[model samples]
Target: MTDLNQTALQKGADRALEKIEIDTLVVGAGQAGVAMSEHLTKLGVPHLVLERNRIAEAWRTGRWDSLVANGPAWHDRFPGLEFEGLDPDAFASKEQVAAYFEAYAKQFNAPIRTGVEVKKVVRNAEGPGFTIETSEGVIQANRVVAATGPFQRPVIPPIAPKDDSITQIHSAQYFNPQQLPEGAVLVVGAGSSGVQIADELQRAGKNVYLSVGAHDRPPRAYRNRDFCWWLGVLGLWDAEAAQPGKEHVTIAVSGARGGHTVDFRGLAHQGVTLVGLTKAFNDGVVTFQADLAENIARGDENYLSLLDAADAYIARNGLDLPEEPEARATYPNPDCVTNPILELDLAKAGITSIIWATGYSVDYSWLKVNAFDERGKPKHQRGVSGEPGVYFLGLPWLSRRGSTFIWGVWHDAKHIADHIATQRKYLAYRDASQRSAKD
Candidate 1:
């Protein structure tokens, strides 16, 4: 830790030992936590933000060195902060994203304490508050906001065969192709990260095999504009009805020059060997489902559906917009979708590295409250927890489809801040009333 981090940790330890009472405690000082703290500060709600590492630690270290935001800098801006020095159309690099969050915290003076790892959060039996046990010490807060983002711990499958000869790493741990040993690489999961990593490896002169799964391949640019622009114009982000039970999908694009679309056909044209989803790995052999063509068809259908929806929105609104000349030509070629490789011998294929791009899941084990479901997902509606005084932020589709993004956090944060302020006022009023009755 740097001197700054050390000082912050010392201050947090001192505060913990004192058992300082804060109106609200926001956990995880990433974009979500910072946004929440900013709103609370504006509301004049006494609150503290606790972070396990430095501000925006995930964006600082979780992503690859070459990783950049899939969305444009213009659309990724948080409330009261926009990309000023950089081109709005350009994608932000990971370093730039982290720096932006750090700047946002400083701009608003968010009360964030770094290096304070929250070990447990349980209800205070003695009072109407909660006890938060941290590495520094303990804190008592009337309310808590779990601002931890959706991506918590990487979800690697337990079915992966144990092999001593082959090296395995999750996509979160992968930096670039140079880090892998010299040999063919098998990347599991055809989501945004899997395809991007496979493409990078193939471009680096390594033989790459990509495992295909159910994924939506939205066009990076549509009708001479970014796809996100159309989504926003069509109000997809602010859709009143939430898609409640759908699995979270990754955005299929890169922050390259002019934004690069991550499509199956593009990867295939780049000489990436496509395979179906991994079934099992046993005794140096890997088994895959034989559904590559079907999966490609499904993705194509989704692409067409998105285009149709955009067309309908344009016609319905009587808006005249020029269509892209290359749109029709850019559609995936069915011939490019390869046959699925049902099985492959790892030794024979010379495949030494297996990258699991499987997604993530939250771990709320430390939360000793009945605010979570059977699967450990928080039981909340638009940041409000079933258990009073506890809340969640930065969840996908929490209020809208964009809830997990930087631009959408402000909506949820403001609502949560207002809710907390109301609770505080009620508590104060009730206490005064009780005292008056006694008098």
Candidate 2:
């Protein structure tokens, strides 16, 4: 976790650049990059890890103050290091998560140089490797692993009007309810962040309007096990993303205030006005789709389906898991659906802020390699890219549903490191064979 802000390595423009050669270079200090470094170290492979900011920068700066890991400590942690003194089912807070990563980096004295940003990476035309141009010195490496992670660019829909009275911010920018202006708040997107933010604002004595959309809702815990435990037992964690026709599922659970199942009906009961997907915002008027009832129904369906599967698994395996029938119960908020507010004048509703909880977009423009498709998605099997020695780690669905999590990225990194080891061996063997031929 060394800060090189005052050093020559941090100032790339003024420093006299020299060619630095290495066998492997990992570009990130987050979970993916650090895991990759660990694997390389185990293989006795020498590589340098470059980071634009300090270790676990995202956890420290990008997230809200009270945010916790969506997954339980036992499920999402890296191997060889257990989350100390915490219950297996308890969620780790953002600061604790950040500290864990920092400790992990220090455990092996990872070759991580913070304050070094990678601007561009391209194939070395003059040689058989890659030329990485960074904020620091340039490095020519036989292999490069782009472990920059999934959440790079935030996306906000361009529908809001110019309302100077209202404070608009993306969910990533939101820290807490006190950060917003004093008035009603509108939270767009019904994903994990959106629901959590809307709930928090409502609990803080603010009138909150939550935009509901297609989402998957599973119980926080079921039958004496967390929902994630069921997923693991069902082999869903190792499975790839479902077909396109299926629902677009983002994690909707919150580890805040002792996590509970996400329910629009329950939120509506708590006075958080649940509306349909936002249609537009213009001229101090906000309109929504007439599908509030449908959204609630959809979430209920997702919830029940998961419970049914869990029950079936228990019965089929002849295991003695409890049959908590109360988990299947749902109380409908008739006013929320029957009297849905499809439109509202911003001034009339007293709404003073809008938090866009829309997710993120992956940016790989700096990676100037033939490893992507027309849709800008990386083209590869697992983490190994089509371009030799160019790999992408810590991406969603890169290998399985778990690839987006800490443990999953570690597995992906190990695979990439093993591949690099094989490639290095091939290089040495080629030289030996050529010398033998000359003799």
Give the number of colliding residue pairs in candidate 2. 0
TM-score of each: 0.93, 0.94
Q: How far is candidate 1 from the true structure (C-alpha RMSD, Å)?
A: 3.9
> Model 1 misses residue 134 by how many Å?
0.7
Tens-place lDDT per residue, model 1, 1-439, is 0012223433554354345667688999998999998888887777788998999999989987788888899898785887758898888888999999999988866778888889999998886879889888877888889999889989889977798788899999999889999999999988778877888899899999898877777777776667788779878888855544345545556656458666687788778888887999889999988888887777777677777777787789887787754554553553435545799999999999999999888877778988988777789889899999999999888888888878898788999899998987887799899999999
Tens digits of lDDT, candidate 2, 379-435: 989889999989999998888888989999999899889998888789889979999
The TM-score leader among the candidates is 2
* Alpha carbon lDDT at 109, candidate 1: 69
Q: In angstroms, how far off is 19's CA in candidate 1? A: 2.0
- List per-prediction Cα lDDT, in the order shown: 0.81, 0.84
Extract clashing residue pairs from model 2.
none
For model 1, the superposed segments whose C-alpha errors exceed 4 Å read 1-17, 240-245, 249-251, 318-320, 330-338
